[model samples]
Target: MDNINVSDPPARITTITSKKLSAKRAQTRIQAFLDDFENRNSTLKGGDKTVTVQLQKLNQALLDESQKRRKSAGEGR
Candidate 1:
């Protein structure tokens, strides 16, 4: 969980990263954030149009980050 700015409109949520953590620990952390994000996102989608659009942007940023990480990791291997 990082870059959480609820005060500002179009809050940004980015990928959860753990430095030097075990694979299991990293997975657990990511899963927890995703679960929480989904719950909140559901509510946002139902309530406000602007907020929903922000969530969509955040979602796409997350996906892009994940893809970048995976590609970099594969290159290292």
Candidate 2:
């Protein structure tokens, strides 16, 4: 039905806010760029920490967001 979006599989933008949308877009771009850079270089972990730093940053952001959501939920209930 309305929930079934065959065209855009995950329905990622269904309830996205402007700031979150921008963050998601930036994450996607950063991931793609990292993938391309790694593929091109093939030695991503030896002397360059670009990919590692990017991954750490993304992980930190996700962790922080999760913590914020959990704290808000606890406060509400």
Candidate 3:
């Protein structure tokens, strides 16, 4: 049997402190929220029309915000 010698130092840990969300990250979060809402209401046959409407509105707002960000980025470029 052969003994292997392994003595390697651990890699340094870098901590990132920031309060900014990228467009892609925001979009992903919005999509996840929408998906969660849909999944929760999937089993419910046909009740709570108001809640459904509100969800749709929120989804639209998310889409609009994302589009505005895209437009602004395009303009900047």
Which predicted model would earn the best lDDT?
3
Best-to-worst TM-score order: 3, 2, 1
In order of listing, the candidates' clash counts read: 0, 0, 0
- Stretches > 4 Å off in candidate 1: 1-48
Candidate 2 global lDDT: 0.67
Which residue runs does candidate 3 get wrong by more than 4 Å? 1-27, 39-44
- Candidate with the greatest TM-score versus the true structure: 3
TM-score per candidate, chains pooled? 0.40, 0.41, 0.47
For model 3 the TM-score comes to 0.47
Residue 69 accuracy (lDDT) in model 3: 82
Which pairs clash inside model 2?
A: none
- Across residues 1-77, which tens digit of lDDT does each residue of candidate 1 receive? 68877887875888698468544455556666656766776864675557545655665666666778888999999
Model 1 clash number = 0
lDDT (0 to 1) per candidate? 0.65, 0.67, 0.72
Candidate 2 has its poorest 10 consecutive residues by lDDT at 15-24
Better of 2 and 3 by TM-score: 3
> What's the TM for model 2?
0.41
lDDT of 2 by residue, 2-76 (tens): 666677756355655544454445556666776777677676446777766778589558556767877898999
